[model samples]
Target: MRFVFGKQDLADSARRAEHCFLLTNGLGGFCSQTLTGGAARNDHALLMACTRAPNVRWNIVHRVEEELTRNGAATHLSTQTFAKGSPEEGWQNLCFAQVDGLPRWVYQWQGVQVEKELAMDWEQNTVALRYQLENPGDTPCTLTVTPWLQFVPKGKNLRKTQTFTLRGNRVTAAGLDLTVRTNGQLTPCPLGWQTLYYPCDAPDGRRKTGLTAACLQVVCTVAPGSRQTLDLVFTLEKTAPPAARVLRQADRRCRLWERQGGFRATAARQLAQAGAAFIARRDSTGGKTILAGYPFFEDWGRDTMIALPGCTLSTGRYAEAKSILETFLQYEQDGLMPNLFPEGKTAPMYNTVDAALLFIRDVWLYARYTGDLDFVRRAWPVMERIVAAYRSGTRFGIHMEPDGLIAAGQGLDQVTWMDVRIGEILPTPRHGKPVEINAYWYNALRMLAELAATLELDGRDYAALADRVRESFRAAFWREEAGCLRDVISGTGQDEQIRCNQIWAVAQPFPLLDPGQEARVVATVQRELYTPVGLRTLAPGDPAFHPVYGGPQKERDLAYHQGTVWPFPLGAFYLAYLKVNGHSAAARRQVAHWLTALEPALREGCVGQLPEIYDGENPTASRGCFAQAWSVGELLRVYEALERSVTDFFDHK
Candidate 1:
C-alpha cells in the first residue's frame, strides 16, 4: 500500500509535519521524519540507534540541512520551524511524497529535481540515505548535505560536546563514537552549537531547545543533463559500504506482509506490515519482545500478552509469538508476569493484575493457532503455576475472593489496566473486582481446563473453578437497573458506570453472560460508549468524564481513563458484536461498515497506521503515540477474522 501524496498534500507545513512515516531495523533502532522535510520532534531522527538490542536507545543524528546551488543561485530543501520563525520555506518546492516500504520525497525547482529516500538494514543498527539529483537546467547543480548530530539518549535534550573529531569522510564525537560516512566529497566544517526548537516537545513539558553540532558537509555535484546518486550510511561499526541493501530488506519485509495474509486488502497489508515493527529482536534474552509503541513506550509484559495474538499469530510470525511467550514465562514471579522489563536491567516489575491471566489466554490462542502440543506441554507447567499463584495469593493483594471471583488492588497499588495515579489519588480506582479482570479470570480457568482435557490430564478441578466463577460473576456483576454489567463490584456496592470494560464479558471465549445479557451489554455499549474511532472510556453523561485528554500530567492522568477513547478495546467490542449477532452476513456487513471510519484514519495521522488514542468528544482527533502496536494489531486481528468469516461462508456454500 503506497500512501502517495502530492504538492497539495505537502503544501501546508502543519499538515505535512503531522503526517509522518516510520522505518525500523528489527533491532529497535528506527528512522522517522515528517513529510515536510526536517524533524518535527526530538524523537524524530534519521538514526535513533538502540545501543542495546531492543532497549537503551539514543538519538545519534537529528536531521539534515540540504541545499541545492546552481549558477550562484541557491534553494534550501529543508525547513526548520522554530518559535520566532522558520529560517527556510522549502515545503513549497516539495512536489511529492510517498510511503510504502520506504519513505521517498521529491523536491523540484527550475526543472532541477532532488529526491531523497530512506531505508534501514534489518540485522544491524544502520540507516542508508540515498540522494539523487537530476539536473535538467543549462548549468550543473551542487547539493550539500549537512547532517545535524545529537548523541543524546532517548528523552534527553542534546547538549554541546567538547570533542568533534573529523577524519577524511568519517566523523566521530567525544561521548558518542559514531561513524558518519558517504561516497560524496566531504569537507571538514566549523563545529559549533546550533540551537533548534521542537514544537512537539513544548506541550509535554519536555526540553524544547535542542543543541546540534555539525562537523562535516557532504557535497555531490550533478552535471547538466545528467543525474548522480550518493549513498550515505550510518552505523556503530564500519562494515561493507552500503550497496543500497536496505531496499532489499524493505522488499523482503513487504513480501513477508504479503505472505502473512496481507494480500487481502490495502488496510490489512498496511496493518500486517505495521504490526511487524513492534516485534523487536531481544539480543539480551536471545528471544523476542513486543514494543508497546513507537517514539515512546518499552517492552511491557501486559502489552506483550495483549498484543501477542494480533501481532505475531495473526501476522503469521508464529515463531516470534512463541519466543515472546517463552521470554515472559521465564520471568514469572509467584505466578505473576512482569508488567515491565526495565531497560539495561534484569529486574522485572510484576505489578499488573491482568498480565498473568492474559498470558494464559495468549498461550491458549498460540496453541490453538499452531496446533503445537509440544509447545503447550512445555508451557502447561507455567500455566498451572499461574493459576495456583492466583488461587492461593500473590503480590498487591491479588487473590481469588471467597465468592469465586478474583479481587486485586491494594491501598496504593492500582493493579488494573485503568491504572493511573496523580500522586496519592487514583483516577480510575478499581480497588475491588474489576469487570474485565474477573472475565479474564473466568476465561483463563476455562481455557486451562480445556488445555488439560486436550492433554488428557486431570481437568475437573479447573472446570469446577470456572463453573463457580461463572455463577458468581452472573450474580454479582449484572445490574438489572442499568441493563449492563457493573464496571466493578466493591465492598460498598457495584459501580454501574457506563464504561467499555464490561464488553470483555461477552468478548472472551468463555463468556459468563447469557445470550440475552450479552446482547444487552453490546447494545448498551454501542448506544453510549461507542464512537467511530473507538469506544469512549466513560460515557458522556457521567460527571467524572473528561471530554479532552491534555494539559499537565495531573490533568492528563485525571482524564486518561475517565473519558479518553482507546482503539484497543474496540477490537473486543467488534468481537462481542459479531458473536452476539451470530457472525451472520448482516453482522459481517455491519462490522465492515464500522471499520470504514478507520480507513480514513490510515491515510490521516501517522500515515498507514493507527494512533494509540483520541479525545472522547465528538469529532475525535488522534492523540498519544502516532503508531501504536495493539491499535494496529487489534485492527489487523479483526480484519483477519472478518476475512475468515467470509471465506468460511464461501467454503460451506
Candidate 2:
C-alpha cells in the first residue's frame, strides 16, 4: 500500500510530523524522518548505523539541508526545527510526498520540479538519495544539498567539543569514518554546532535539543528545458553502491516480502512487508532475532515468542522462525528464557515468567505450520526442561503450586508483560499468577503432550499434568460473580479487575475454559475493554484505571499498564471471537469489517505500520513507539485467522 500526502496533508506541520516513514537495513539500522523532511525526534536520522548487528547503533547523519535556486531565486527544500527560532517552513513548497517501498518527495515551485527519493542499502550502514530535477522554464536551476553530521551513539546527545575532520569526500568523527559519494561537486563547508529542537521529546521531559555540524555540501545544476539526475550516497564502508542499484535492491526485497504470505488484502500484504523490518541478525548469538519495537526496544524474549508465529511463521519465513527459536534456546537457563538482551550487552536478562512457556507454544505453532518434526524433536528436551523447572521452581519465585497452577513474581520484580517499576514502587503489580501466564502454561502442557505423542514418546505424563492444570485453573481463576475470569489469582486474594489478559485463556491453541465460560469471558471483555484500535489494560470503572497516557516518566510509567491500550491482545480477542461464534459467515464478515477499521491507522503514525499503543480514553492518537513488532505481528495473525475462517466455513459448507 502506497501512502501519498498532497499539499493539504503536508500543510499541517504538527500532523505531518506525527506521520513519519521508516526504512531499515537487515542489521537493525534505519533511516526515518517526518513526512515534511524534518527530525521531530532525537532518534530521527538519515543514517543511523548499527556498528554491531542489532544493538550498537550510532547516529552519523542527522538531516540533510537542501535548497533549490532558480534564476537567482532561492527556495529552501528542507525543513528543520531550531532551538531558538521559528522552524524552516520548506514543507510549503512540497507538492507531494509518498511512502511506497521507500520515501519519495516532490517539490514544485516556479517551474522547477525536483523529486527526491531515499533508500538504504540492504545489510549495510549506507543511505542513498537520488534527485531528479526538471526545469521547464527558460532559466537554469541549481540544487544544493548539505548533510548535518553527529557521530554519537544512538540516543546520546552530541557535544560541542566533538571534533570532526574532513578530507576530500571522507569525514572522520569520534573514531568513526564516513565516505560520501555524489555525482555533483562536493565542497567542504563547515558550519559548527547547530542546536535542533525535538518537539516530540518535550512532553516526556527528555532531551529536546541536539547539536550537529554541517561538514560537506553537494551542488548540481539542471539546464533550462531539460532534466538532470543527481545521486548522493553515504556509507561507513570503504565504498558506496550507486543510488539506483541500492533503491532497486531495497524495492525488490520489499516486494518479495509482500508476496510471501499470499495475503489477498492490501493491508495484510503491507503488514507482511513491514514485518521484515523487525527480523534482524543477532551478532551475539550468530542467529536471527525479532526486535520488540523500533526506535527504542531491543530483542525481548517474551515479545519475540509472542511475535514469531505471525512475523515469521505466518509469513512463511519458517527458517527465520526456527533460527529465532534456536537463538533464544541458546540462552535458556534453568528452563527460563532471557527477558531481554540489553543493547550493547552480551549477557541477557532472565526476568520474565511467560517467555519460556510461550516458547513451547511457538514451537508447537512452528511444527503445526511447517510440519517440521525434526526441529520439534531437537527442541523437545529443552521444552521438557522448561516444564520441569517451572514444576519445581525458578527465578523470581516462579513455581507451580500444589494445585498444578503456575505462580510467579516476587519482591520488586515485575515478571509479566505489564512490567514497570518506578523506584521501589511497582505500578500495575501483577505479582501473583497472571491470567495470561497461566493460560500459556496450560497451552504449553497440552502442546507438550501433543508433541510427545507426535514424536512417538511417552505422553501420559504431560497429558495428566495438563488435565490437572485444567481442573485447578477452572476452580481458581473463574469468577462466577463477575461473568469473567480474574486478572490474577494469588494466596492473598483474587485481583478481580477486568483486563485484556483473560482473553488468552480462550484464545490459546488449547482452551482452558469451557464453551459457555469462554463465551462469557469474551462477552465481558468486549463490553468493558474493547476499543476500535486495541484493548485497554484495565476497565474504565476501576479506580486504578488511567484514561490517558502522557507526561513525565513517572506519570507515563504509572499509566503504562494501568489502562494503556495495546494492539497485540486484539489478535487473540479476534481469534477467540471467531472460535466462540463457530467461524460462521456472519462472524467472519464481522471480523473482516473490524479489521478494516484499522486501515486508516496504517497511515496515521508510521505509514504501513501499527504503533506500540494508543491512549485508553481517546485512542486516535498513536502513543509509545511509532512502529511495534508485536502489533504488526498480531495483526498479521489476525488476518491469517480470518483467512482460515473463510476457508473452513466453505469447506464445511
Candidate 3:
C-alpha cells in the first residue's frame, strides 16, 4: 500500500509527528521517524543498527539535516525539535510524503523540488538516503545534507561529550565505527552537539533530550532546468554499497513479501507487509524469531507464539515459522519457554507460564497449516516434556492441580503477559490461575492429543486430561452472575473482574466453554471491554480501572494492565465473535464492519502498521510501541479467517 500524505496532512506538526513511518532490516535494526522528517522519540534514527542480531542495537546516524539553496536563498528542509525554544519548522517546506517500498519525502520551495528516499540493506546494518533534486527555474540550486551522529546504545541518550577519531571518511567513537559514503562532495566539518527534545516521551520521565553531532556533510548542485541525484550511505561495514542498489534490493524484497499471502483486501495485504518488520534473525539460535514490538520490545516467547500464525504461517513463511518454533524450543527448560532473551545476553529468562502452552498450540498450528508431520515428530519430545513438566511440576510453582486446572505464579514475580511491577508493588497481580492460562492449558492438552493421534501415538492420556481440565475449568472459573469467566481464581478467592481474558476461552483452537457460554462471554466482552481499535484490559466501573495510560513510570506501570487497550486481543475477540455467531452472513458482515473501523487506525499511529496499545477511555490516540507484532499478527489472522469464510461460503453456493 502506498500511503500518501498531502500538504494539509503535514500542516500540523503534532499530527504529522504522530503519523510515523518504520522500516526494518530483519536484523532488529530499523529506521523510523515522523512523517514531518523529525525525530519525535529518542529511539527514532536513520540507522538504529543492530550490532548483534535481534538485539544489541546502537543509534549510529540520528537524522539528516537538509538545506536547499537556490540563487543564494536557503530553505531548510529538515525539522528538529529542541529542548528549548521553538522547533526548526523545516516541515513548512514538506509538500508530500509517501510510504511505499521506501519512505519518501518531497520538498518544494522556490522552484527547487528535492525528493528524498530512505532504504536499509537486508540483513545488514546499513542505511542509504537518496535524493533527486530538480531545478525548474533559471538558477542553479545546491542541496546540503548533514548527518547527525549518535554513538550511544539504543534508547541511551548522549549525556557526555564523545571523542571521535576521523580517518578518511570513517568516524570512530564509543568503540563503534561508521563509514560515510556519498556521491556528492563530502566535507569533514563537525557540527557540535545539539540538544533534541522528545515530546512523546516527556510523560514517561525518561531522558527526553539527547545530544547529537554532525560528523559529515554532503553537497550536490543541480543546474537550471536540470535534475541531479545524490546518494548518502552510512554503514559499519568495510565498504558501503551503492544507495540505488540498496533501494532496489529493499523494494524487491518488499514486493516479494506483498505477494506472499495473496490477500484480497488492501488492508490485509498492507498488514501482511507490515508484519514482516517483526520477523528478525536470531544469531544466538541461528534461526528466525518474531520480535515482540519495535523500538522497545525484543523477541519474547509468548509474543512469538501468539504472533507466528499470522506473521509467518498466514503469510506463507512456513520455514521461518518452524525456525521460530525451534528457536524457542531450544531454549525450553523443564517444559518452560524463555520469557525473553535479554538484550546483549545469551541466557534466556524463563519466567512466563503461558509461553510454553502457547508454544504447544503454535506447534499444532504449524503442523495444521503446513502438514509438516516430520517437523512435528521431531518436536514431539519437547512437546511431551512441556506437558509432563506442567502436569507434574515446574518453575514458579506452575503445576496442574488435583482438579486439572493449571496454576502458576508465586510471590512478586509477574509471570503472565500483564507482567508489570512497580518497585515492590505488583499492580495487576494475577498470580493464581489466570483465565487465559487455563484456556491455553486446556487447548495445549487437546492439541497434544490431536497431534499424538495423528502421529499414531497413544493419546488417551491427553484426551482424558483435557476432559478433566474442561470439566474442572467450567466448575471453577465460570461466573453465571457476570455471564463470563473470572479473571483469575486462587485459594484466597475468585477474582471476579470483567477482563478480556475470557475471550481466549472461545478463541483458542480447542475452546473449553460451551457454545451458549461462549456466546455470552463474547457478548459480555462486547458490552464491557470492546473498542474499535482494541479491547480494554479491564472493564469500566471497576475501581482499579485506569482509563488513561500516561504519567511517570510508576503511574504508567500501575495503569499498564489495569485498563489499557491492547489491539492484539481484538483479533481473538473478532474470531470468537464469528465462531459463536456460527459465521453467518450477518455475523461476517458485522465483523467486517467492526474491522472497517480500524482502517483509519492503520493510518493513525505508524502509517501502515498497528500500534501496541491505545488509551482505555478515549482511544483515539495510540500509546506504547508504535509498531507491534502481535497487534498486526492477530488482525491479519482475523482478516484471513474472514476471507476464508467468504470463500467457503461462496464455494458451497
Q: How many clashes does each candidate structure show, in the order listed? A: 0, 0, 0
Top model by TM-score, which number? 2
Candidate 1 lDDT (Cα, whole model)?
0.82
What is the descending lDDT order? Answer: 2, 3, 1
**Ranking by TM-score, best first?**
2, 3, 1
Instruction: Quantify how close model 1 is to the true structure by its C-alpha RMSD in Å.
Output: 2.4
lDDT of 2 by residue, 387-502 (tens): 99999999998999998988899989989998999999988788777889998998888889888989999988888998999888899889998889988986544387899999
Provide the TM-score for each candidate, comma-separated.
0.96, 0.98, 0.97
Kindly report which residue pairs in candidate 3 clash with one another: none
Model 3, global lDDT: 0.87
Tens-place lDDT per residue, model 3, 75-140, is 788888898876777788888889875789988899688888889998989998899989999988
* Location of the lowest summed lDDT over 10 successive residues in candidate 1: 644-653
Best candidate, lDDT-wise? 2
For residue 348, model 3's alpha carbon misses the true position, in angstroms, by: 1.4
Which is the winner by TM-score between candidate 2 and candidate 3? 2
